[model samples]
Target: MPSPTMVASFRMLSSQRPFLRHIRHTPHWPGKWPTVSHARQLTTGSRELEGDSPQPERPKRRQKLRKIRTLDPTKLSPRDYVDFSMLRQPNVELVAQSSDLNDASNALLGRLSATINARGIRDGKFPPNTAGFLYYHTPPYSPPLAGEVRFRITPSPDTASLSEGNDLLTEYGIPWKIPLLHMTDKKGYTGLQTLLLRDGLVTPQLLDIATSISKSVKTLSRIVGGA
Candidate 1:
């Protein structure tokens, strides 16, 4: 038979067995109970990782674009300045006395004067009422005139005047044999009448009266400012 002291000791050990199994089965440190210092170190490491966690990346700031300054063409030097007067003027009178004048202006004046003198053109006028004229930045508007075709003129090829003039002749169905002007007779004024008739430039009855006047006049010299 067992004594009372042995029985009491066995009962106490049985009660502690469950507590020992619970400690062994805890998942915190696998099979071991965590020490106070080690638990504190783990807690501190977790806090550090949280503190060092990367925040959401901020968006990059866009750089501002540079502002470009606009240049005024008129504000430039006189030679470089673009003259807008040609757009408004029906007839531009050019004098090459000033060196500051643009090249086109000077060239037009010289060329037109030379052409007029060479052709014995008394009045700075050609047949069909066309005359050489200048533009803002361009050479003389060849076939150059400020009449009906002045505003219609644009920058064209080197032979544009000749070509357009030919086209105009074709449009009017005028034969090439008719001289542009007559040095002696009134054929040029008569041709002008023909052109005016074809293009309907003026009323028919009025043109007929003008034609009669042109025929009655002895020479174009008086009309063209020549004695």
Candidate 2:
């Protein structure tokens, strides 16, 4: 019973109501969209995580190596120090003196004098037959002397006389002398005698003689020098 215009208007209104209902059920519909509570919670959780995280610091570089320190020789103590003036010489005579003497004289002279004083022979002591004497000159050349020279004088007779004295000679007689003959007797014979007896081959007797000579030399050295 409705009029034609009214019927048309009612049809249009019905279509618009269905469309609005569809829009209201959709998630992104502006008029009836869902609340953003879950999204906001996720955003807040991300922000809190970012705030709790710590940033890593960078590592530092290593320093260069330093040079090693060295000890100075001048600051070090001397190995040997001796007083030559305090030393005593028995048969040695001081003939000449060095003008260019240095502080090292004590070390040099003390050592040399000690070596000589310990090896010197007392009065009335005969020189060993196996003993040999070596004389050295100022030029410092050792000239060979007879083993029987009966003195083991150092610095040479002429040179020693010019530089020092016969005191060394008097203290320790010639290197080679009749006194060493007794040592040979104790060992039963000389090296030459043992060699000749053995037909040029070294024999036990020769070895024994050598050993005895070595012992004798050691004894003499010990007696002459406290060392």
Q: What is the C-alpha local distance difference test score of each model? A: 0.35, 0.35
Estimate TM-scores for all models: 0.19, 0.16
List model 1 lDDT by residue over 1-227, tens digit each: 99999999999999999998887887764676668998899999999998896779889975322111111111212221112221211222222333655644345333221111112222322334332222111125633111221111112323244224331122234321222223113432332333233333344665455445545564565667774
For model 2, state the Cα shift of residue 180 in Å.
5.6
List pairs with backbone clashes in candidate 1: 131-144, 141-144
Candidate 2 residue-wise lDDT, 1-227, digit = tens = 99999999999999899888888777655564336986687689899998897778788864322110111111111211111222322122111122455644323333221112223445334333312222211112522111111223323323323223232344434332322223243433232222222232233554456557767777998899985
User: Model 2 compared with the native: what TM-score?
Assistant: 0.16
lDDT of 1 at 53: 69
**Could you report the Cα RMSD, in angstroms, for every candidate shown?**
26.2, 30.8
